[model samples]
Target: MQIGYFLSCEEYAPESLIQQARWAEEAGFESLWISDHFHPWTDEQGQSPFVWSMIGAISQVTSLPVTTAVTCPTVRIHPAIVAQAAATSAVLTEGRFILGIGSGEALNEHVTGARWPATGTRLDMLRESVEVMRALWQGDFVDHHGEHYTVENARLYTLPDTPPPVYVSAFGDKAATLAGEIGDGLVTIPPDADLIRTFRDSGGAGKPVHAGYKVCWGPDAAACVSTVRSMWPNDALPGELAQQLSSPKHFEQAGQLVTEQMIDESVACGDDVDRHLDAFRPYVEAGVDVVHVDQMGGKRQGSELEGFFAFYRDEMLPRMRELAG
Candidate 1:
């Protein structure tokens, strides 16, 4: 399994993200996953820079290959545009980029003043969007009229020798089957063996399966749990609410239901090396090809950030790599 660092666009500024990418590379992380979001989940987290610009900057600073943890190209942006941006990103990174995409959430898509479609419609739109992107990436003028999108005479002038791989993100069996059929890889957050099985059984065999796990590394476990509960309570929000919620305020309201015990049970908090490894073991055992770790505390900088990376480099990463071997 490849080890990676997840760049939280919602939590960090552009420069801080780039710096963290450098730190991740220096700490022996093999790749990077950056979240693409139009808004932060809560007022507390408080930052959401345009992801493509940050990716361009990241390409300049690090040799590590990067992927968006998941970008929703079906609604806020046309897939044709996403194809162009992704193609350019591939060129900028010298073909070290993967485009991870999903059906999208209301919070980002609703900003375009477009009506939020039902889940089935969104998935259908996502399928058509992928088709549109793939057609544009062929470097020919594309004319497509699908149920959800229309592209007329669109051609991506700039593209890498090989188009970046498109990884589909899924949280349920139906979506996993879609990922299996259409994606070069699969991207999901949890370590669900059943989900993995569904993907493979539905034709995703031998494809990369990627997941992200959040961790808060510090001296105090309780403090870290409190910070996670305050900053990322939305993570614990159940079901399709994450996709349907239209704003940060709604998320904040829903997050009120997330208890400290839930946060403690779900996330890896504090500096226990064994516990950190245990948090990741589920994904590894579930056959994830790559696991991206997102550090959950506030601006990870100075000694705090440095210490976390150092610990991973010296203690955690080696053991994880050995387990992978």
Candidate 2:
């Protein structure tokens, strides 16, 4: 299994993004995946940078392949704009970029005074948006009128030698079937196994698949959980994200549900190298093509990286290679 890093460009300045990308590449990470969002999800999280601009900058600085973990093309930004930005990024990277996209959350899409559509509607929009984007990337003047979008006489003037490939993310069966039908690849956060099988059986031809899970490599598990709560408390809750979005103020309330036990289950927060390797096993066994690891220590440097790099490169990656083979 190939190892990759998932990051939020907002948390790191351009210099830091470049620095970490280089570090990750040097440390043997196969790819870099960055989050795309206009807002920080909530005020408590603080920063949200233009992910495309950051991607362009990252292309200039690192040799590692890069992808948006998942960009939402249906709202806030037009699919045409995302298509153009992706084309430009591919050219700059000399064809090392993959466009990872999904039906986004209300927290990001609703910021523009647009109603956040239900999940079913969002999935419909996603299918249509992908069709439009693929048409635009072909470098021919195109006119399209779809339920969710319309473009007239549109063409991408600047494109790479080969158009960037697109990877779609899906958490459920219907969405997974759509991703397999349309996307060149698939991206997910520790994707459900049934969803993967659905994609495969739905005429997917063994395309590339990427899945990510986070690790808070700190000495103190409780401290790590506390740190994660500071940024993403609602993530601890076990329910559909839409169910939790009834009240925006509930983010804080949902955050309170996150406890040390919850943190320990998902994240490799202790000092054991063997434990970290064990944490990543199910993903490999599930046939994931790329195993993305988010080093969730955030801004905590010094010892965090010191321990993480040692455990990951020395122990975890090697075992993963054996398992994958």
- After aligning candidate 1 to the native by TM-score, how far in Å is the CA of 322 from where it should be? 2.1
- For candidate 2, the per-residue lDDT at 44 reads 64
User: What local distance difference test score does each model get?
Assistant: 0.91, 0.78
Residue 308, candidate 1: alpha-carbon lDDT: 82
CA deviation > 4 Å runs, candidate 2: 242-249, 300-303
TM-score of each: 0.98, 0.93
Write model 1 residue lDDT over 1-325, tens digit each, in one string.
8999999998888988999999999999999999999999988788999999999999999999999989999889989889999999999999999999999899888998999998788888888888999999899999998788889988889999999999999999989999999999999999999999999988899999999988988888898889888888999988999999999999999999999999999888888988998998888789999999988874733366777888899999998888777
- Score residue 296 of candidate 2 by CA lDDT: 63
Global CA lDDT of candidate 1, please? 0.91
Give model 2's TM-score versus the native structure.
0.93
The residue-by-residue lDDT of candidate 2 on 1-325, one tens digit each, is: 6888777653555566667777777777789999886655445655677888888888887888998988999988999999999999999999999999998877678777888888888889988988888888889998998898999989899988888898999878878898999898888886578888888887666798888877777677677776676666555666576322644456666667677677767667666766677778888778888878877655654467556666677777777788778
Give per-candidate clash totals: 0, 0
Candidate 1 global TM-score: 0.98
Candidate 1 ranges with C-alpha deviation above 4 Å: 300-302
